[model samples]
Target: MSIQVGDRVPEVTLKRLREGLETIDTYTLFDGRKVVLFAVPGAFTPTCSARHLPGYVEHFNDFRSRGIEVFCMAVNDPFVMQAWAKTQSVPDGLQMLSDGNGEFTRALGLEMDASSSGMGIRSRRFALYVEDGIVRASFIEEPGQFEVSSAEYVLEHLPG
Candidate 1:
């Protein structure tokens, strides 16, 4: 089963390119934090580029003002994620993370097989609202669809 509300985020390391390639574990990233982690199937894809990431970027401050940290994750390498971040003009505080090996995605039962598209294994489109490492809400999109996982939907449905 995929991760559900009240589930603790799995322990796994995710890569982020900052001053250097940084390896951060899920615990360190999520513990004691209210985080909105939205994952895409790949970096630089059409829907993800035009709508998914940009929506979060446009609403970054709204989340932050609510004391929530936002993170964008994909099944691409750290280099590609960093490049995509720059191209998207992502805010400094909106983290771009790489689940290059799909470890975390699989651990959450959220990995999708995109081998038909030559993308190999990827994360399903989803947004997770986590508080202090426990999931408070989860919005998972259907394959080939983009609705529930959008930033606006997640923001509107965040638990009070």
Candidate 2:
């Protein structure tokens, strides 16, 4: 079953590109923190590059000033994630998490097979608002829809 608002984020080890291939434990990452985590099917795709990811990057300060840690996650490898960060000139505070094995994505019940599109197993675009590790709100997109998961929408729902 898909994880819902009351559910804690799943325990998983995801790789991230720091100065090296650093591992992040999801449980450790979210503990005692309010987090805004967004997932995209793949990096460098049109909608993701143009709007989804950019929306978060552009609003980084709004999230941080509210004391939320902003993370952009994808099933792609760390190298690609790092490249995307550089390409977009992502501000220093926002994080890019690489779920190369889709462990975290699958646990959230948000993984999808995009093999027909040559993208393999990927995440369905969605965003979550987690307060001290409990999901406060979830905005998931339907197939071919990008309405609710935008950063602007998530901002509106955050407990203020």
Which candidate achieves the best lDDT against the true structure? 1
| Deviation from native of the Cα of residue 8 in model 1, angstroms | 0.2
Q: How many times do residue backbones clash in model 1? A: 0
lDDT of each: 0.97, 0.91
Report the alpha-carbon TM-score of model 2 versus the true structure: 0.97
Residue 122's lDDT within candidate 1 is: 98
lDDT of 1: 0.97
Model 1 agreement with the true structure over 1-160: per-residue lDDT tens digits: 9999999999999999999999999999999999999999988999999999999999999999999999999999999999999999999999999999999999999999999999999999999999999999999999999999999999999999
Could you estimate the TM-score for every candidate? 0.99, 0.97
Leading candidate by TM-score: 1
Candidate 2 wrong stretches, greater than 4 Å:
none
Each prediction's number of clashing residue pairs = 0, 0
